[model samples]
Target: MASLTLPRHTGFFSGSLPTRPTLRYAAPVKVRMSLSESGPSIAVVGVTGAVGQEFLSVLSDRDFPYRSIKMLASKRSAGRRLTFEGNEYVVEELTAESFGGVDIALFSAGGSISKEFGPIAAEKGTIVVDNSSAFRMDEKVPLVIPEVNPEAMHGIKLGTGKGALIANPNCSTIICLMAATPLHRHAKVLRMVVSTYQAASGAGAAAMEELEQQTREVLEGRPPTCKIFKQQYAFNIFSHNASVLSNGYNEEEMKMVKETRKIWNDKDVKVTATCIRVPVMRAHAESVNLQFESPLHEDTARDILKNAPGVVVIDDRKANHFPTPLEVSNKDDVAVGRIRQDLSQDGNKGLDIFVCGDQIRKGAALNAVQIAEMLL
Candidate 1:
């Protein structure tokens, strides 16, 4: 993959990350998205990370508002320069005291960083929209997907000095629900089996670079680099790298099972998933088999999704066209295809569908930002 050519920074903004004055990105030739001025006081936690950078892009793309904004990361990332919306801002080290008077904090750091500072920021009256697994299952926190269940975080708002936490569901869960939820609203889903083909972006930017580097090394007849994953990732697919639990499911797979029940707000729903890591650069694809309590014909399900928000259908049998990760990269909508009735089930109660979505955008950054938008 070719690297993006970005403008060189001229200077840096220093001192504790400010929250009152508006910050702007350095001007670049690329078309810039409009920025909203009526938004809350926002902070992007883990600003040095891949997902953290994505948070800024999504915010700009949506023209999300902010009274002020802060760029925060680990100590090592401190003093680094990041340009956004034509303004250059310095990355500041995150600390417990970082969330004073902040209205919303979008957190994408590793679970450890979110685990440590998430609640602290919330205590400081910041609404923490965490993009990690640390608090998804927490009984107190409302796990949310804005398109699917905005009601989950109902009554949470900005300007209330008191803290609140909202957990962003796993990327796979978010993409799956985007298509499945519409159909489910028409006919209740009783059980679902999921098989995912996740891309390298799920592992972060370094892993993406490693995949590209390894592909080159392999093409050059040299040993592939194995820094990110234990095995060679070039031209290969493997079971997800997440740790396997005692229940015979890896953590990633289990997240789909657990998160679905929570997001759907149906404790009785049965879900099983098998997640795999593929060589794709971005977006995630899943094969989902759903058995509904009532018969949901393929045509009716298709119509429901046709009117659904944040979903695009690409199922065209004549052209043999369907949703693919490459097609959905950088797109906000999750694409659904391969919509058909399941033959194995007794009746039309069971159906199978394939879904594809950009893991970095809709799956992570956009979802978090949408949650923040509801607060305003």
Candidate 2:
């Protein structure tokens, strides 16, 4: 119920209506509100996207504390309806004014939209849990994984006129680090060499459809056209998404490298990643080789991972069992298996591990919602 003054800037207004203003707060203040009695009023931006849909599902499944909910999307998706908590809510067009009186806003739209509107939502005294890359690297914004950094939310000011925006890490980075961070605590993670097999869902709804349609055409003995992807996505793998930087790493790969270091707060830790898009619908699997500051045996490394939080160790060589994308799909916990020492390297200093996680849940939607829950 507190408001901050907006600076007079040309970009702050479109035509007649004053556009949302960017707000800055010295510190967060909590207003005396009974969330238990009335629940928190919440809004979801980009409600039509895959991650947005997952956000809705997670909120309902987890019974998040919310009194009311608003669904906002692009003009094309406006008037569409989604059911939640046994009630239907119509999607509204996203605009500067859409976040009025919203207690919390979950953003899953592209980075540009998040950049333009996220600050506006924060100015209106709404806490934003953003699932985009826009604010992840911002020093002021907290990139959080609830299992690893719930304490990071302690610094967030909910209602004191400060726009609290927390960023969720990239899907690949989130899944990989969820399995690796805990192990780093016991043995200092000196370097990480990782390759990712990502699902089509990571690209978005259209990419998923493209993979499906292309697969169908190939099975029917027809020519398959690639649109959502630069090349055929059905029964194929591609190493390109966005563009490859001068360093030969694609944007997706670089995101994993940079984000991993930040999340672990270990700049000295070395990380290299190769991200590939596979034809799977959901879940992402990673093959990781880690070099530790202190030498750790395979059994000891496996024990640390087995007892790690948000991790399920599924290593069983005799039964030929290990974490797979299909098995970990739709699951929240990161699955780790195929634990071994990298004999290719001298000494038992390096460990090899495989991890699988639902890129939609633990990677994006569920993680953002969990951060919100931690704040509550």
Candidate 3:
């Protein structure tokens, strides 16, 4: 596999690990790795995938205190060399016995892999932060977005000598709710309509590479490759590739709808979504139309969002600048803009907002890491 160029300083290995990826936003302070014999013992499942690489980046950037860390991936990726925090480790083949001493296992290997090994790890007392839809809708599993509902997984902690599963919500759902939850708390959301403009990163590294390749091939006047997506991905937009259900909503669309209800714990809240895949390389932008139970002045909503954790209000009508996928590509905070009262609905009761967030970082790796942080 050819190396895929990722954002600078993110510490992701494209195909092989030759040099460590640099850090863009980490503090000047030297990050301490396994130097000390304290903190949770960590394991990253699917260490060769995009999100797997990101897990290392976030952990290092945040200076997460981990006494020891193991990189686990599929058999094909096993024995590959990767470096994190100045230490080189060989990727290990993931198996039922891999989680013997792992206190926290971050799983992003897809639903099938997660289903097979997630419980096996948890049963061995590892706190599994699964980034798959496999367990998100499970009533027993806590679908968590750290900023929105830390309380949902309240008592889950490391060293319990017991295992648990915490599901990360869909990327679009996380980006949407990061901006919407603040306003929801202020005025109580009655209904939410979300339309996602997602990027190739949401589809994984191969898709990103395919998009880049297609773009190049098209510009070179050659036939574009269409392996990742059946249709041309370069300079094109298409409905999300998730399989459509009997209800006519694809899996991606329904993920947002159902995840919002689960994350918000508001089964009564009406939610609808339409997901689309755009040509952007990273980050996801969402157009949210919200109807509140009580009137929430646009100005008040903006103020509320400005103070929301993990959210940044970028509404600057005078400049005509709003949250763009490129602006939030590798950043942590979800950016919000286009904040205004919805003219289609009653005054101060409905508002429209645009939000952008890095689907790979905050959506998957960072959110799961944040959940791990709460365990401490």
Candidate 4:
């Protein structure tokens, strides 16, 4: 018989957001409030994309206070209709002029779009919480994961502060940190080795659609579509499609290393990662190996994760069940499992674990909203 150990966690962790948050849509927005009426005037910069759609869902789920909200996208998407907060909205083409009178602009457009307009929005006094890599590495721009580093963005708030930009870390980085940070706080991680199984959703809605179309085509004995990826992605796994750096690490992998360093505000920690895009539709999974400066027992680690905010423990050894992307889809909390001490290192100084989270929700939109909430 296989060894089976139920998570059996004792308590919850602090310094985190709500766990298992529901993502149901809000009732149709009955009335449209004006920017001058009350609450903050908001803008969704990439209102038609995947993460963009998620931003709307999260905003409604949390009942984020807004006197008005603008759905801004590319020229092509202008005039398209989207419903939110019980109200119907026509998408507007984002431009230099869109940020006027907007209080908080949630940006989910591609890097180029964010690169151009993020600064513009900030210059116009609109606080921009950008969900792209565009400004994450900018020293002056505070990269934030509200659960882990809210203070990194201290002094900025809605309605009362000068316009500034805050960068949301990559989805993989966010999900990993949600689980790892609690443990790191206790054990002081000295080195980290991560292997990721990413989902098509990380690529974009097009990539996700391609996967679905290709899967159907493959089942029907047709040639699989290969539009979004260089290779068939429906039922096959491949290395992350990000450009390879001189160090042989892909951009996605490098983001894990660099972002972890910045978010933790710890420059001396050693980290490495190998990222692969699996056929999963929505969430990302990671196998994280850690070497800690202090001893951390496996049982104690489980208890810490159990109590940690925004972390769900699913380590079921008897049933051989653990965190899966399917279970975490559209969920707010990151699920952690496979916790065990690394026998390779003496003195209980190392351990291994698995983590999964919805790339679009906690990894992107929900996270951005959480940071925005802290400012209020």
Candidate 5:
């Protein structure tokens, strides 16, 4: 396993705009590499969605080495054209045969598609970095965040001698763990209570439009209709999604609890989460109260997070400086702030902190690409 050195520039593309293609993507060309540098052809499984778009952006922004790049999606999006490296690539309908010559496949489509076709892609000798909940808990599948669990990538054995699939953690889990994992290294994280302010993008592009449309209706004195959600998403927050299980917890909330435990590899670590769908467009924010086995002071906790990998400490209560969803919308580093001792607990053994990160980057596409980089 290799350790990732944190990059100096924390913002996505360091001021480069994804809406406008840079020189890096201005020409129809393949990256030339030596024999050792050369590997396999690359493919993006869900090339039409938000995360899929970010995958393309990161691949270009980081200048990843690949001989050829293929864009694959459902039949509905097959005719769409996407540009990368200054070249236009027509989207192709996803099929089992799509993995014939692909070396690496980054999957961000829903779990059902991954469960159905991910293995076929791997069997055809393609390394898959899946961003879904489908195979994340599978013992054979390695759920990875390059910054926190690069070692998990090593567990992905290429059985077909060409490719293997690696799972990306849930967006909420990824952002939360990036800030909490480093602290766990210093002190045992016995339990955590998190209330998340998740953006509509996490739900999908349609949810974002629903939020906008409903907001317009409400402001115009019209009754808001629920389509993407069970209730009004504009000027309102709902705690329900998909279904509520027998345990009295919603599926999304349960995912956060289980996924966090799996990522940390500590079943003893207790996590209670309230996952709420907010009207924000991009970033995800969390208010976390952590109880440690030993006493951890607020100052020391701040120091730990400030120096931790993949985390940026932005604590300045005097200046009202703290991370916001807008501040972290397009940033890669997880921003931590509002650090304080939890006085409700005895002996000040608990710590309270706030964190925010771009759900699409560290929480999704960028994290997967970073794992592939570590493997290289």
Candidate 6:
């Protein structure tokens, strides 16, 4: 994620003026790697969506090595111009021929698009890192969180002349597991419960815009616009918009439950989640409760998390400062705090924690880029 506050653009090249600027992180060190002619060829599917735009941002921020890059979107967005790595490129309509010479394709388009083109691209021997629910649970597709389970995609690599589909876990699952997995590694998690306060970004750029627009309209004594969602989003919270399943859990909550089990490779691990949409602009916050197989003290858990890669402990009981969505916005590291023993569980076998992460960045683009980096 770029440290500088950037214009909230629909795509890399298009932008709408913001009535209220969202705060983002400033990178302490920016790694600038020049694109090498010998590097892997890259293509970004859904190049006009929010996460698609973010894909470009993360690649540049991390200085990902790429021999060439193509911006791909629907026919509507094709012929558009965008700038990346100090070069101007015209967006091309994604087609069967798009992946011909591409080595790695980062996909953030909706599930339908991914389902159709993901396999087609991979069939061409382009490693497709798909950010959708399409192939997440597919036995053939490796649902990956690079920090948690890079091994899931171990044998699959670039230049194998073999294309494979890799699924990026749901943003909520990615955020929660980033904090819980470290502790799980120390003491096996027998069961896990998660409550998410997701932001509008998870719904796409339109939801974010609706949130902003609704806020202004509500403040002005007008009926809030409800295009992206069914209800007012400015000052109210509601159950996530995902369809409610017969089992009573919405799709978002189930994603957390199922993805956790898959990523952990522990089908027996019990998991449950309640997902809610809050009025935050970006980033998702999670409250996680864990029951471990053996005892793990809160201090030990804290220390483990502090040393964990892609995790930062922000617990400050004295100051009452803990992880907040705003604090983690546009930041790569997931922030974990509110570390304490679960009073409901006996002994030190259980703990509770709060986590926050930029859904678009670490929860999506940054994670995908990290997976691509492993290929090199």
- TM-score winner: 6
Instruction: State the lDDT of candidate 5 residue by residue for 45-121, as single tens digits.
Output: 88777688778767766677877888887987776655466556778889988988777899998999999889999
Poorly placed runs, candidate 4 (over 4 Å)? 1-37
Off by over 4 Å in 3: 1-35
lDDT of 2 by residue, 263-368 (tens): 8877888999988888887789999999988778889988888888889999999999999887876677999999999897667788999999988889998998
On the 0 to 100 scale, the lDDT of residue 67 in model 3 is 83
Query: What C-alpha lDDT do the candidate models reach, one value each?
Result: 0.85, 0.79, 0.87, 0.85, 0.78, 0.88
Q: What's the ranking of the predictions by TM-score, best on top?
A: 6, 3, 1, 4, 2, 5
Model 4 weakest 10-residue run by lDDT: 5-14
The positional error of residue 159 in candidate 4, measured at the CA in angstroms, is: 2.5
Question: Model 4, 82-191: lDDT tens per residue?
Answer: 55554567788999999899889999999999999999999999999999999999999999998898889878877675899999999999999998999999999999
lDDT of 6 by residue, 202-295 (tens): 9987788788889889989999989989988998999999999999999999998889989999999999999999999889999999999999
Off by over 4 Å in 6: 1-11, 14-33
Clashing pairs in 6: 3-25, 3-26
TM-score of 1: 0.91
Candidate 2, which segments miss by more than 4 Å at Cα? 1-36
Order the candidates by lDDT, highest first: 6, 3, 4, 1, 2, 5
Candidate 1 — which residues are off by over 4 angstroms?
1-38
- By lDDT, the better pick of 1 and 2 is 1
- Pairwise lDDT winner, candidates 2 and 3: 3
State the TM-score for model 4: 0.90
Q: 272, model 2: CA deviation in Å?
A: 0.4
